[model samples]
Target: MARYVKISSLGPAPCVIEAGGSAEEAVERMIAHWKRMLGFVLPDKPDLIVMPEACDRPSKAHYPKEERLEYYRVRGNRIRDYFASVAAEHGCYIVYPTHMQAEDGSWRNTAQFIDRQGKLMGAYHKNHLVPAEYDANGILYGKDAPIFECDFGRVAAAICFDLNFDELRLQYVRAKPDLIVFPSMYHGALMQNYWAYSCRSHFVGAVAGLPSSVLNPLGETVAQSTNYYPYITATVNMDCAVLHIDENGRQFAAIKRKYGPKVKIHDPGLLGSVLISSEADDLSVRDIIAEYGLEPLDDYFNRSLAHRCAPGHMEP
Candidate 1:
């Protein structure tokens, strides 16, 4: 069972708005800018599209704090609605990141999940915020890490500053979502690969003015946007697992001999762990593991821990 999902990450620089422009004009310009960016990937027919954090905010505009708040009030959910329409039209999931005012009169730095039907599935608010967000701005910190279930797989999100905190990362590690979508103003660099490997999930990052990338469970870059191109699309198979090579070397060879080209055993060199994915239509990674009696990397580590902590083996 190969669950292949095509994803596109757009990393265009933030759209610019005039300092004295009306909110209505500003919203129109933002939409137009995004529309042009979307034109690059919609032709690829991606299953999901991810944009950068604070995507609707203007780049170089210098508006007073009060005026900016007023602009957001007037702009409202119009830009979100436009994105929803595009999602429905293209029949793809979208991660729309922005600053939104809540019903309680508090604002949140949010990444909203828009389903293929032009409906909002859920949102992951920024769990970790910088002091400036709380001090200069009135944005409240998000309290929970929620996983959204899409047609393809379970999804989670992390905003710009949220990547630095272990509190949010630990939650995602325990839950183990299939994919983590990161929409950020700042690139997390090695942290992106670390998060993907730690959680054993695929990572897609859309960072403004930087390279947007798609990495596999092995933390290997499958696709990336470059300076010449601001957008990139890559397809990933969700039906995969990671296993230690120490005990599974023979089993890996046997699987390859049996399944041949239908299975992929990817070794990222010195890690001593390999990512196994199924390419056949009839068998899944779980089926192959069960058939071959392979131990997952995490399970092996946990079992070793239990053995070390046994009553007879425990040290005084």
Candidate 2:
């Protein structure tokens, strides 16, 4: 059984994540919560660590995108070092996912996951960024989903915004990872529905996206909390779920085939690979990337806000 823990917690300090606050203090708070929530720290310190978005206070936007990106990169490294030191102290591998950061000055948003040895393991750049933010332009928006390797098993990540797109999840699924973690900022009743639907619909065994609660590989609600700030954990056994396949080496599913004659649902899950062919002309490569861009990442960021504002585009 694979153990996946999801926690709904608060930031360490008021201004650390925002700017002009102590990042060390924020990390300390996060560590304390981890120890208290998980009962005991990892023996090998687990291969991957998953964390919610924006846990740290962000820096003010006076600096240009390049400078801002550098600032976050440096700060992210510091924060990871802090977490890694703790993971090493306790003995476990960690894949910490924080708010997206852009390095190389190319305007790409990324999720950095480090291992127990305090080495940068792998990163998942936001192929799908939120549109409103200025950083959504150029190299940041058009990209593919990449999964990282870990000691326990292959792992992939879904940012808070990535979770809403079945396409992103389908892309991660193609990686055939043993686990997929989503670190999000959403809560309340709506999250309640997503929590349940994500398990039953998306991940067959591994947790869908992390939030206040966690679901098991079997899509079962293993644990939850009544408090406003909550954390939950469950063990995942990768060998459990079967990856459906046909004789032609194609995974089989008909959900999209069942759509209306003019509309087709592309089940990226049934087919391996983030880029898949579909009969649906409406769904294009650009559309997929636009929906999942990283820098401006948000749950509903990709939806057509423009069309909604202009009623003329609405069909009768």
lDDT of 2 by residue, 1-316 (tens): 2223222222121122333334454455445544554343243234344555544424234224454444554565566676677556655555555555455655444556666576677777655556644444353563666766666566666655555566776565445565565554543334333433333222211122233444433344444443443433344333223221222122222323443332222223533212122234455323323333311111232344665668677677
C-alpha positional error of residue 11 in candidate 2 after TM-score superposition, expressed in Å: 8.4
How many angstroms is residue 127 displaced in model 1 relative to the true structure, after the best TM-score fit? Answer: 0.2
- Which numbered prediction scores highest in lDDT against the true structure? 1
**TM-score, each model?**
0.97, 0.53
Global lDDT for candidate 2? Answer: 0.44
Q: For residue 266, what is the lDDT in candidate 2?
A: 27
Q: What TM value does model 1 have?
A: 0.97
List RMSD in Å for every model shown. 1.2, 14.1
Cα RMSD, model 1:
1.2
Span of 10 residues, lowest total lDDT, candidate 2: 200-209
In model 2, where do residues sit more than 4 Å from their true spots?
A: 1-47, 58-76, 99-103, 135-139, 187-211, 242-316
Model 1 C-alpha lDDT versus the unseen true structure:
0.91
